[model samples]
Target: MGTAPATAFDTEALRRGIEGRDAAALLSLYTDDAEIRVVDRNTQPSHPKIVHGRDQVGEMLNDIYSRDMTHHLDRCVVQGDHVAFTESCEYKDGVRVLASSMVSLRGGKIARQILIQAWDE
Candidate 1:
């Protein structure tokens, strides 16, 4: 029998891919029907940018990959098929963003992710 896919979150690979801004690598970890909700200072708790499916997610990923910045997974906690993590990023021109995410996995791929972020003005 084929071994089941790993449900455990691979923090190292995830961190490396994000830090390097490899959108493809990031996308590879998501399911085809994955959804992502993004909330920032502009998009508050009530109103979030909801990205549905891999195609839309790909666009968002492309945007991230286009940015000239450094990414780091500051902290992470995982239980079962869920994970929560804080991300720190410093972009060019001295802009810094701190983000936190709660993610759910399906079939070892990210099925949903909710993110909240804040950037220095």
Candidate 2:
């Protein structure tokens, strides 16, 4: 089998994606049925959940991005088709996290992405 694409996903692209609110670039990393779950640190009892196709992911993220005051990508590690990273962001509604995620890629796009976070817990 041929080797995978040398998709060197760095902090810049991620930063741009978050700061500039580029959901298209962000969602392009995922597959058609990709899922993203963000456990909100600000909420109690339950976290703000997001799901569905790539379009929903974009819409959810775009909503947050539009109202976000600050977004910072703290750390990232990319290994072949997998990526693990921490992102810190705060919205006007007082939502935030130093969130970490593990993303598995298939055919050069995200097959599955899972996120977990621990802050003020």
Give the Å error, residue 12, model 2: 3.8
Candidate 1 off by > 4 Å:
1-6
| Worst-scoring 10-residue span by lDDT in model 1 | 3-12
| Candidate 2 per-residue lDDT over residues 23-68, each given as its tens digit | 7767766678888765655442266465777888778767756764
Task: Give every collision pair in model 1.
Answer: none
Best by lDDT: 1
Give model 1's TM-score versus the native structure.
Answer: 0.91
What is the lDDT for 15 in model 1? Answer: 89
